[model samples]
Target: MATTKEYRLGEFTFPRGWFMIATADDINSYKPRQIRFFAHDFVLYRGRESGKPVLLDAYCCHMGNPLGAKNTTSYVVRDNGGTNIEGDCIRCPYHAWRFGPDGKCNQIPYSKDPIPESARIKAWRVVESMGAIWIWYDPEGGAPEWDAPALAEWDDPAWVTPKWDNVGMLAQHPQEVVDNISDYAHLGPIHGSTVDRYENEFRGHLAIQRQCGGHRTLVAADGTRSILHTITTYHGPGVLISDLTGLYDAKLLIMHTPVEDGSIQIWHSLVVKSPSGAAKAGITDAVTAAQFQETSLLSFAQDFEAWTVKAPCINGMFVPSDGPFMKQRTWYKQFYNPRAKERDYLDRCEGVYVPKGVVPYSEATVA
Candidate 1:
């Protein structure tokens, strides 16, 4: 498996950002779900009383037992009244030790001794947003400084509910996948799109790619190609939100979470505007939304198919029309380095251009 160092990404192996771990519906008060990301095991669960989400290291600090273990007869659940979780804390299956939401060991059953200060696990900062559960990961153990990108259309009554796809794990690094945003040369060969104008912008932790193109195959039956104007933004290193217009007003959510050194888990979703505006009347048309979702997924699958088969691109030969690959890579390095070293990277790289004073709905303003 190829590592980030092999690709020469930066100083850190996993970049810092709010990466999606699971959907909002995936976790509930019933039982804790075990998930793996950044080469570490984590337990995700919702508070039985507070109803808020919590993410903690999977291992119990007392005896190294899995907190979210399934199909096991252990003291945490079997001996402790058959319930492994109480309120916001999860009890260890081996020793019946209870850890709070703050990852501190609070209870040790049958032992009169007080819980030691070292009896604690690491708890991650998590938030529920955009129909997904996002965890803030900082190697330096820092808090989130910026808000996740907001999808305003999600709340609009005219748009339908967002549909999602769990693309599963791919044997490729995220930098290779992220490079596709600024990869202008592949538009024609990969997705059958011809570019008219392409530009990329780097703003602190954000990288934006604006493309004005025409799709050759994804057009009307009359073979009339519709011009596509898209604004793709990278909220940090993990979440990508693309606002697309032309054939349809749509929003595409793409999330990449690193599962290991070289592999990543991907999730994508699409939402389109409703024609009849029945959503305003408190009615959701599932049929129309499903039809549009199929078309969007078909297009996204093409990229997935190609990415899975190709070898990792450690170094690439560049051309003038290849877009801002170098600049984007430099911006990506900011997440890998500490806050102090981020400026060193920005000083050596050039930031791309983002069109100012252009409305998204107007096609005439694309040029």
Candidate 2:
């Protein structure tokens, strides 16, 4: 796998952001589920008491046992009670050592000794929203500065149920995936879309791309085209949401979470407005929603195929029509470096390519 230095992103391999670890329905309180992200192992489980999700390092502090593993003899499943988990805390399978949601060891079954302060694993800050579990990660071990995004469409009664596709993982750096936002030249050839207007806007950690175009598709016996107005926004580095208006009022969610130094796990989901305008419209057709989801997956597959097979572009050769690749990349580097290093990158690359009417979100005015 490629490293951060391989892509010339910065010193840090992973960027700071709220990345999706798993869907909410994927985990349960029955047993701890083991997950690997950022090249590290983590255990996720729902708290039996609070009924909330908990995330912590996968290994046990006492004997280096995996907390998620099912062991009949280990105290995790047998000690004090039939199950190892008491409320939200998870017991180590080997020694029955209970660790709280805060990552500190609270109880020891065999010994009457005080738990050592060092008997703790790292507890990650996690939030459940939009049917997914997002974990906040900072290379420097700092807290999240911004909140995860929430869509108003999620709560709207007119929208149909959402559908998700596990696009799976690709062995490439996330910088390569994020680069697609500023890539305007590829719309015509790659996705069969004629771009009327393309622009990129930066607002602190958020990156927004607006594209107005007509997408060509086979609507009938003869090939026909439909005009689509799309506005895509990146909440941080990992999550992207696109609101598209044309034949349908639809929303597409694309999330890329780094599973290793150079690989990312991709997820795609789509939701569309229901034909019937009722809150509990039993009239919404599941078949129509599934068909729309299939079309969305086909459109996304074009980008996914190219990203998986192509060579990594560390320093891309830029052109006038290629969009603001340099500016976007500089903004992306801020997430990988310390807060202090952000200014230097901004100073060097800001104002290089400001869109006609869009204001650049930087401290200094563009020349």
Each prediction's TM-score against the native? Answer: 0.91, 0.90
The superposed Cα distance between candidate 2 and the true structure at residue 305, in angstroms, equals 0.7
Best by TM-score: 1
TM-score, structure 1 vs. true: 0.91
Model 2: per-residue Cα lDDT over 1-367, one tens digit each: 4668887778788999999989888878777888999999999999898888999999998889988766667645765466667789988877678899999999887888888899999999998887888999999888787897567776566676675688999999998889998888787888887666667876677788877656764122233325577788888899999987655667889999999899999999877776444554244444565677778889889999899898888768886657888788888888889877977876655443444543333322311
Model 2 TM-score, all chains together: 0.90
Q: lDDT score of model 2?
A: 0.79
lDDT (tens digit, per residue) of candidate 1 on 50-109: 888989999987778788768346655765466677898888877678889999999887
Off by more than 4 A, model 2: 70-75, 78-83, 218-225, 277-286, 347-367
RMSD of each: 3.4, 4.7
lDDT of each: 0.80, 0.79
